[model samples]
Target: MGEKSEANSVAPSARGSLHEHHHHHITPLKEKKFRWRVTDEHSPPEIYNWTLYLSVFVFGILGSARGYDEGNISGTVAQTSFIKEFGLKSASLTATQQANLKSNITSMVQLGSIGGCILAMYTVDRFGRIRTLQGVCVLWIIAAIIQCTSHSVGQLYAGRLIEGFAIGQTTTIGPTYLSEVAPKAIRGLCGCIFAGAVYFGIMLAYFANYGTALHVVGRNQWVIPTTIKCVLAFLILVGSTIVCVESPRWYMKIGNPEMAAKNLSKIRNLPVDHPYILSEIADINEQVNLEKHETEGTTIISMIKEIVMTKSIRYPFFAIAFMAQVLGQWSGANAITIYSPQLMSLVGITGVKSLEMTAVLGVVKFVSAYLAAFFLIDFLGRRRSLYIGISIQLITILYFAIFLTVVPQAAEKGAVLTHSQDMAGKAALAALFLSGTGWTMGFNSIQYLLGSELFPLRIRSFAQSLVMVIHFANQYGNSKALPKMLLAMNNFGAFYFFVGVMAISLCWVYFFIPEVSGRSLESIEEIFSLPWYVIGRRGAELCPDHSEVNRVSYNVEGTGNAHGGDIDYETKPTAEFVENASNEGLMKSDSQSLEK
Candidate 1:
């Protein structure tokens, strides 16, 4: 009877405390509805607004610009007219000169990208995400104009370098911006749209190149396709300037909490103090405070030390960030993306047929990327999707190597294939297509998504800049080395090398990468704070309870103790308290009551 009375007393007080908490923010009439909505985990998707779609669309267009730039060289280099006009096809030039030309044209952009990314790291924080995007868009337009009117190889190189710089900056900023603005429920889907845009851009380039090769004459063939990139860049500039909202998280981080609440409300299509908006704002503010504490006097040296010396910060996340770039680059996908026409020719696909085949490959990649964005990423989860995709890539690359090795005509320079050799070449082409699918499904989308999620807010931009630097360095090396390597080692040796890299990547994903699906960005930090063993096991598990985090926030803010005079309605019994209650034979009833 005493226990029952105690329970009744506690219940009323708890209810009253919770009521007071709501009354602080909400009118009584709306409190009941707000409580129900905020507590429900599976609320329907937020209403789609033009501002939301426009933000994603602008980012997508920037991705398409990147795709167009990457795919343009593949088909352009293969054109007889392009080579003839540039003195590249002349017997007067040494093989080394020709290879150097190809490498420079492709690699200059990557070098530029590295520079642009470094600049973006500072600019994104200073000028804001929207302005940074707009500045790059203008730079890309000027670079495009230079390329479209180039009178010499030097001019082309200059244009590509500038364009590459712009692409690099956009690549870093676009996905990060999208991730920040998107609602957690559909964040994965929105993040992957950037990947989808990349593939779509690639497809546009391929088809444009194919049409030019078939119908256009002389330099116009290359000129028309190159100009298309400028159009995409222009669209992004306009969209960003006119339609995009500043990231609410950015506003919060910059000491504008009122503006942050306003922007978030606008994005969410809710009142400024709606429970969902309030909860999100609270999560953002708490995370910012935690990061500030973690890196008290933030500096380059201190940030580096924190990442390298802090076990919780380093192990899975820092390591994963580095590996994400390595896997994305060394997975052999970029080699195919930039050199597809050349690779197809090595497999005995020549002339217009090879260009068409490259277009088909682009289509396959586009479809796979879209599928990953819409269906695979959130549904299969990050780790499983990566494993499945890497497995397919490994199989396809091995098959490609085997086919090249067995068919001497495919590997031998200037050798025409026999009937059987032709069939083998076609089979290798099929493997190449499948490899694109696997890569898009696994590495392409996930790398960008993971890069955004892996770090705390305080150092996320710098950490991502570091990742992009390595990413472009790898791309630059591959673009510079791939053409020469293909000729020197035969296509078979190159595939074998990629196979070895992919094998290493597979092992890294299995042991190191954790599942992060369905967890809020703030919750991810808590997951990493667990003992390494438990983190490895349940890092991806949904954390339905927020009381622990609430307690941490209160304590960090120097608020009163959990059991003090003013009740925190958000607090719940700790594990120790629950265990003690179990010992006293009150566990079942107390647990049920607490849950209710």
Candidate 2:
């Protein structure tokens, strides 16, 4: 941790002249030499920028509810009150009921997410991120209203479908909104909220379920849980309506430069003449120019094709898509989140005593996820966290698999067994806590950050939309297959299956996922150079500067192969890189001269 902090401390000054002479360069320190304030950090406090913090907080709250809803359902059903009230009691009613509830809830939510994601992608620039977030919060309210009045299972499913759309939209746009608005130093951590909120939601659900089910919440039991979720979602809607600000970058993209500059200053808590603010505005202008060219000649389909066909673009896609899903999911993380109680039972953790142990596991998950959020943007950076987290995940799952193997009875008899071996079971419980700890370290935090960072600004929304679609598909598949896999193959089969996937995923990550820890979204070319094959072979050591930092070829020659050759870490490229006329006219001037 100290090592990374030291490296970052050296970053800003380390490359002082790297691109300082570019066409558009601004330094507030030189231009506003006489005008100084005593702010500790670069930006002002939230009090002065209360509107911005309020906006982010509101979205965070709304987003958190969606996560809570998704996570809570399993534990909610596990409650005796829910099982009894919902008629999920009889052996005949169990399988079909469980599958139906799972499918109806998850599918509806995911399907809505697909719509929400699509809408956000097209309309974000038009309506703005804050507006979209505020607007989508309405879906949560409507879903809540319908759920509160639901008389049948069918009605609940309808509500879930509506809620799903809102959740999908939130996932697609929320991270980008946070990333663009946050300071560069904390951007990774800011983006980490997308996943952190989900885990927080899980924690909320766990505690809420325990509070209402275990404690006394009155006669109309499940009503309190459902109603509380509804109210929280509604409050998010109201709060966002009152306080959220539109993204400044989104404003610049749509030709509202004045408002963009104004909002940027407001959100960033900067003086109008701040140097970093000037850089931000310059970057926005660059983006605007790029967008203008795009409007004249590009179609979304063509853009998608260009990205896929372009070797540089395809590499990040392969890395993120493979790692985000495979490493994140292959760890059997979701199973623990969605089906821990049942899993505990399978592994012989049952009765009141077992529930207490599971509670400890939940707390560990909560604490570890919090640790991830703290380290994610600040200490580990994005790619570093993924590397360390994913590596740990591989090791833990292997051990988990081994643990399941050794305790063969955990498979055949279920986790809830007779008390003949209480001491042995206690040891097993400790192991379970360790497994949960491992999961939160990498699995919980990596998903959202990787999804958000793996694409360029132009295609971020679309890429994340596609990523979420796969995410829910996998969720659906796992939810459907898991119980049966557990019962049929028993715990051993389930563990082995996930271990196989994790092994393959680790290889993909080792080979492909680039270190994007602290780079700007505009600087994605670095990642583009890392092909899946290379990532498999070299890991982060590929970058001449830092193994994790990806690089791009700005060389007009189009043949320098910044991404292709054995990485030249020992020597640096010369400055007099000539433009290659033979290169396609699509090449930009800044192509070569990309620095270490």
Candidate 3:
């Protein structure tokens, strides 16, 4: 007893002496260097400053480039003058010829996008996001050059393929970069920027095409519109390469804490010693170390296996890309965006007016998407936002269905049709604009952010690739189907088909998806464990205080002296288990459907 007492007494003194010696050795410079104190228990930085938002905004702008590439082609292709210059006159051309030409163009682009999405998954982690984006942009420039100079339809298709590949890479990678870099509080808003930028790009494309189509540039005028888009894309590509900062999380992944700290400080614009910054950096490091493999290389086989075999990851793998591609394509969005001018012309509006209204629709999409970013997503959370937007989408589609089926036709019996047949076109346009707003407001923002978050670090690339493949499948369908749909069913039949799909998708979300707003990236793993009902009902526990849960919720049993609050013994479920219970119905239905 005496010896133990003496040892205990000496331990404090020794510790104190060591502490004092360490204190003495820490110079002012060294103090500044290792100033930010963080442990696993703490949360990351909450407050965002102007500089951080500005830096992220630049990323948003770069994302807009993808949108520009997508939107430009649709509007430019519609102008009659462009058709004439491209020798698309029906009097001289067969229906077979037009179908073949459009199918060839759409197919090539979709295929290229598939390649880009898959390639980016592997290359992004190795070369870093910025460099990969730079490569895509360079390809865009080269493709644009080819497109502008195309003497034959085959060359145009080839150029589109290359452009599609670049777009595919940018669209997939940009959101991944944005979500990782953004703080949780504003992540949804930052996420919306990609959608907004895309709509804005489309709007810009429409406006540019409209102006160029009207330009007095002598003989062949299609050259100018394509040229302008290529120039803009090239400029953004170059600008982003020089100015964009590497994602702080990415820096941490590469085993460089100093650079990570420096970048974090720049991103947050907080002092280097900020508690939140330190916490985030530590969390990222912990995650990377915990997840990284023994080998440095991320192999293709491992990537595929991680997605398919892992129970925790497969759901998100299917969900996000499915949502993006379906909503972007099947939910009538791609068909609408690509054929807005034609839809308008069919309704009653045509020529300059149809083009102008298409531009207006693009603006509406931009504004609504930005508003979704600013308020709805962060405030209401992902599932609620999705519900609200999708509900509105359903309602809009219903309106189109009713109008299409019941509304009187424009051609009065056998009267000579002097003007463009417009009643159907107008109704379709109204429905499209309304549905688009809903699409952007909910699904567009959530899919990319949610998809990126759902997969584990090991499976992220494969999952993204798989989802994108699904997405392009829908894109290919919509692109090929639109003209045929328009020709066969007319506006009403085409609009109703998408309406039915939206209704089906809405049910999918209501039954299966868990709300995931304000949750940390790591916590997303829990999605697989909770019962789907529990997830849908409880939503995710967001921004929980990460301090000692025991201290916070201690149970006092059969004791006079009590400490803390009584705690429930119930343990949280894992993601895999949760998904199984939640998805039992879905699994059965899918099996039955497959059998049928």
Each prediction's whole-model lDDT (CA): 0.73, 0.58, 0.61
Expressed as tens digits, the lDDT of each residue in 115-194 for candidate 1 is: 98888788888888888888998899899999889868899899999998898887778778888887655567778888
Off by over 4 Å in 3: 1-47, 217-220, 293-298, 407-428, 539-596
Report the lDDT tens digits of candidate 3 across residue range 54-160.
Answer: 65666676656556655666665666655655665556668757755555564567778878887777777778777777787788888888988887777887888
Task: Identify the candidate with maximal TM-score.
Answer: 1
After superposing candidate 2, which stretches have Cα over 4 Å from the reference?
Answer: 1-56, 91-108, 216-219, 295-299, 351-359, 408-421, 529-596
lDDT of 2 by residue, 470-520 (tens): 676566566656666766775667877776766676565565656555455
Ranked by lDDT, top first: 1, 3, 2
Question: Tell me, what's the RMSD of every candidate?
Answer: 9.7, 10.8, 13.1
TM-score of each: 0.83, 0.76, 0.79
Scored by Cα lDDT, where does model 2 land? 0.58
Cα error, residue 3 of model 3, in Å, equals 35
lDDT of candidate 2 at residue 412, scale 0 to 100: 48
Candidate 3 TM-score over all chains jointly: 0.79
Using alpha carbons, what is the TM-score of model 1? 0.83
Deviation (Å) of 435 in candidate 2: 3.0
